[model samples]
Target: MKAGSWSRLAAACLWLATAGCSARRSEPISKAELLTDKPSERGRVVFMEHCNRCHPGGEAGLGPALNHKPLPNFVKRYMVRRGIGSMPAFPQQLINDSDLKDLMSYLTALKRHERGADQTALEEINSRR
Candidate 1:
């Protein structure tokens, strides 16, 4: 091949490699890192089994990030049941009402922890001023 063609191919390969590296995702939460309460623990299991693939650690993967969304629990529940856009609907057979409730609890706890971390960082920055 011509030198120009070889250089262009090398640049494309380099770009693809870097792009993949940037897309590397965070690790999934472990059992040891359970947020709080028994419900959250149970919900964590449910989330790992069902939701983790698309929403790893509640962060965006194949789907949008759940951690930062300010949606209500009921809305989230409805979306899980009915689905929207690329997300598939999860029926009662897959996740019963009780498990769903537990999942919500886990999600709430995760959001709370995330918010607390953000607030703490902001407070620290302000204090340093």
Candidate 2:
């Protein structure tokens, strides 16, 4: 290959690398971390503003109640980023990767906590035997 061609290829490679380096990878958020006030609150606000249009608190509206079993990480992220059915995609500007992770964690934590509460109640009743 000619020197000029090689130089052009190198420049292209460098540009691609620099661009990739600046792009942020989505990090997995911990359930405990999201349950906290900061990220959780941000997520909650984002949900209410964007999702509440379709999904009501408990009762179903345009969409099903999201209070069900905590969705798998992929599903949650997909729903937020890609949107399902009639849902609209939440852009990264509105909800970044961290925000999405935190929201998913918070929602899942809520579901798990409810399940634990129910189990405790069941155990108490069984102990009466």
Candidate 3:
């Protein structure tokens, strides 16, 4: 085949491969409804589907604990969308406006729970002494 033909063929193949890959994961993630007006349940689905893989239970997994530091919301938001350190950036498409709102709720709730759990565990351990 001519050089031009080869390049065209390669481009076509690459496009097909990318399209196929995206199609496999294209099924929209059904977001869970917020149980209340509170932001607490807002980001649960997005968090579970994406963030949980790295930040299991919003605690340290492959990624560090999101709440342990309690940094500013903008900072966290920027870091998550833009990525920081080892954590990967989560584009708006994967986490739309609604998903991001709910995710903030999930993260906030997770932080409070983690704090409580930590205190409880410490108390229990001390009691054993």
Please give, for residues 22-109, the per-residue lDDT of candidate 3 as tens digits: 1111112112222333555557667778887987655556965555554556556766786655667889888776677677766655
Query: What stretches of model 3 exceed 4 Å from their correct place?
Result: 1-38
Model 3 scores a TM of 0.63
> Which lDDT value does model 2 have at 65?
55
Query: Against the correct fold, how does model 2 do in TM-score?
Result: 0.53
Point out the worst 10-residue segment of candidate 1 by lDDT. 22-31
lDDT of each: 0.70, 0.54, 0.56
lDDT assessment of candidate 2:
0.54
| Order by TM-score, highest first | 1, 3, 2
The candidate with the higher TM-score, 2 or 3, is 3
Number of the top TM-score candidate: 1
Better of 2 and 3 by lDDT: 3
Q: Which segments of model 2 are wrong by more than 4 Å? A: 1-37, 116-129
| True-vs-predicted CA distance for residue 31, candidate 2, Å | 22
Q: What is the Å distance of residue 21 in model 1 from its true position?
A: 22
